[model samples]
Target: MLEQKHYDVVILGGGPAGTSAAITLARTGASVALCERSRYQENRVGEMLSPWIRPLLTQLGQWEQFRQAGHLSCPGMVCCWGNSQPYENEFIFNPYGSGWQIDRNSFDRSLALAATEAGANVFFHTLVVDVNYEERFWKILVRKDGELRSFKANFLINALGRSQFPHTKEKIYLDSLVGVAQFFQNVSDFAIDDRRTLIEATEVGWWYSAQLPRGKAIAVLMTDRDLLPVKPKDLEAYWKKSLLTTIYTIARVNFWHSANKLHIYDARTSYQDSFSGQQWLSVGDAAATYDPLSAQGIIKAISNGINAAHAIASSEFSHAVSFNDYNEALLSSFATYTTERHLYYDRERRWEHTSFWQRRQGNHKFLYA
Candidate 1:
């Protein structure tokens, strides 16, 4: 038999968004419960952090913890594009501070453990089955050990990444976004030569390669669903071969000889939902997701989580005002990133001698206002 429990807040999903929110609320003396369906050790990409996340982690006092975890330090980015003739540019983001490349599994679990240490009740391997909202509270149903258990909370946070709730459908559709990544070990030799990470633009989309703290390298390829015919089962093979054919990648083949050791990071789909609802709020990918070409996944996730926590703790609204504020912030961030991407893409497109480059350079669908 399962026991009944009550909390001031119940957060679904234990990724950066949920854990950070729980940690913040717990510090404010609120009773919080976090539910994560997957085990903490699950492997995933989105491990690269951006320059903007440093202050938030510092404020939360977790900067030292992240450093101790052996995250790769990245001072900036180097981007290359075009074929027969290519233009390469390096942007050192040192003014914004150096970012870290993490083992997401370890990083996420660390956040969850931090939440626990801060007094948030943390539950792993527990899946949220259904949510029933009432006039004063919410009834959350979960399946544990083949039995259904229910709990109540004064507030609920829908941090369920990529899982759309019933009310979220009309707001946004994520069926268009696509992402794929891989991890390779024994890459120390390449690390010494390629001091900074590289982002190469290709026909399908963009690709990123960076060295991890271990003697490993992480490479990711991202594009829209409309451009590629990738099913879940064959996504690995499709991404591997597709990446190898890119002109820039072929130029740097020597650095990728250990490609055979590649471990596929599952290709993922995502969408952005308008942040508006009562008694429930969505943060991180649950609210909005940018194309991975921006490499802002974890940074955006943690930043939004911190913002959501502040809004929830300080808000006086009974409805969705707080969530609306969060949405505005995210849109602003995305706007800046989209602008930079277009600039790089346009410059590369103009330099190419091939038909593919001409078409890509002409394609301006992602241009931002």
Candidate 2:
């Protein structure tokens, strides 16, 4: 048994939000520790960063590091929204300039490494089994490198991409969006179009295809949970049928053939009833999740990371208040995102009667459940 450890703050989950908060607070002289369970052994899908994220990276003092990492430049996005002809939203229109199509595994690892370099103790391959709040501090039990360890902190940050607090409850689930993807080898040879990302709205749902740095490309279908083709053969057949609904994807999937298997993941939107308590705060997706169509997940997570640190510093350092301001602001943002999501979804009138579309149109709701 290792001896107990102590820090001013402890963060769970070493992805962008946790690492970003650690970098901000540790540099300000706070003792910070972050626990991360894996080194990204699975395939991740959120690989595109919009141009608006460039300034946020600069604020994190990571712009130069991100530039030197050699990620592919994202030209912009092309969408088949209300009509069949694709509309282009180029990066040139963004004030912060070019976006990125990243290899998420390398990008996330870089952020974690940067946090350690900023003086935060980082525990890779560690899982925090349970957290107990007692007498103005949190007692965290973790399994680290095949050993159990104990740690204590005055403030805890949940960046685990899901709520881990008893005080907070999910007020509502806006929709049950699902993202199913397939990767094909050697796709660059067949794709002669501009390297920009392609998104098309179909009868059943929407589809996304992006060119990667290697000779590969990833294509995903976004629909509701109820629409997922569960059976092995059915999923394959449905994916092909959905792809064929769009002109941009018909040729792309046909080029690869139906050889690779599909991977399905949650892309739902929901907000916690509360975002912060006196001793703990939830940042990023743990606080609120957005639709994948927004392309704002990465930016929101990094920005929230910085905001969480600021909220902590302002209150406890001044001995004035708790985290109510943080909670209010997060809730406000969630409301605005919900409104915007509905507007974009309303644009696709072709499949209004379908279950996937009906869910987004706000026709069905177990509101406040």
Candidate 3:
């Protein structure tokens, strides 16, 4: 006979959103299972976290723990957008003070740890092989270490960032934006002082670079997929050539240090047709994804997780439970995000005639992929 376990809630993808929901539900005396695909040893992206994240951590009761994690403090950001002149968006003026530049792997593990401490079953290196809904319960099959485990839950939360299951709705992509990134580790004793993130806009696209903890750093180039001048085989060469076009971003990199190979990932703005259904709902990047320029992906994920947990808890013992408010809030936020994104992109008129800018300026219709 196969091993089978049941829980009040089963969350897929132990990212910020999943762990947030798990921590919340577990604290409320609800049995929760949080499954993560990665083993937590690999490096993940999305390094910068704004100061606004403090409240969310505090709400989850992990603020002090996060403070002691030793992540680098980000005082502000430096941008060269709209024109050649660089400007500072300092955070010292804000009441929350400095944000953080973290090792994403460690950050995520911390959240999962919090969930476990809150009485949730946290599973790593677990892959969801199948999902089915029947008889008012979610039947999920997961594979871990050559063994298959079955789980049944009264409610399911989809926090699977960027990767959706077969039951989820299709994602409507607003654009084909992608990011080519490279990570580096300082092999020698090279002292550097500037900690603010750098964003330099060029005719082709934009560049983002930041200093991470432990003498590590990352630099990424954002551009439309179709706008890439070279094919996949020549992407590394193209990445280097594009770096030469930047004014300030180039100064932030140390070519002499050992760097990882170029990594390409989707950085587009997209949303699902629906966010919630009967006994199931999506959260974080699974429901909607924002452009990295907003720098609110993780924040949005944590917020969604917390909200979803409440919705589930409220409906657990009642048949009249409704997720309409949750859906409406997500839609409203997306609408506002779209408008703000348009205005931000419009600010860069130097590359108006370029295909990359033209698509973002509403000259091109949204394409389905």
For model 3, give the 10-residue run with minimal summed lDDT: 360-369
Candidate 3 lDDT (Cα, 0 to 1): 0.88
Q: Please report the TM-score between candidate 1 and the true structure.
A: 0.82
Can you rank all candidates by TM-score, best first? 3, 2, 1
Badly placed stretches (over 4 Å) of model 3 are: 187-191, 317-320, 362-369
lDDT of each: 0.69, 0.81, 0.88
Candidate 3 lDDT by residue in tens digits, 24-90: 9998999999999987897788758999999999999999998999788999999998999999999
| Cα lDDT tens digits for candidate 2, 268-325 | 8877767877678889888888988988888889988999988876665442358877
For model 1, give the 10-residue run with minimal summed lDDT.
261-270
Candidate 1 stretches with Cα past 4 Å from truth are: 1-3, 82-96, 145-147, 170-177, 189-192, 229-241, 247-273, 316-324, 334-344, 350-369
Q: What residue runs in model 2 are displaced by over 4 Å at the alpha carbon?
A: 163-167, 189-192, 256-260, 316-320, 362-369
Ranking by lDDT: 3, 2, 1
Alpha-carbon error at 274 in model 3, in Å? 0.4
RMSD of 3: 2.2
Instruction: Please tell me which model should have the higher lDDT, number 1 or number 3.
Output: 3
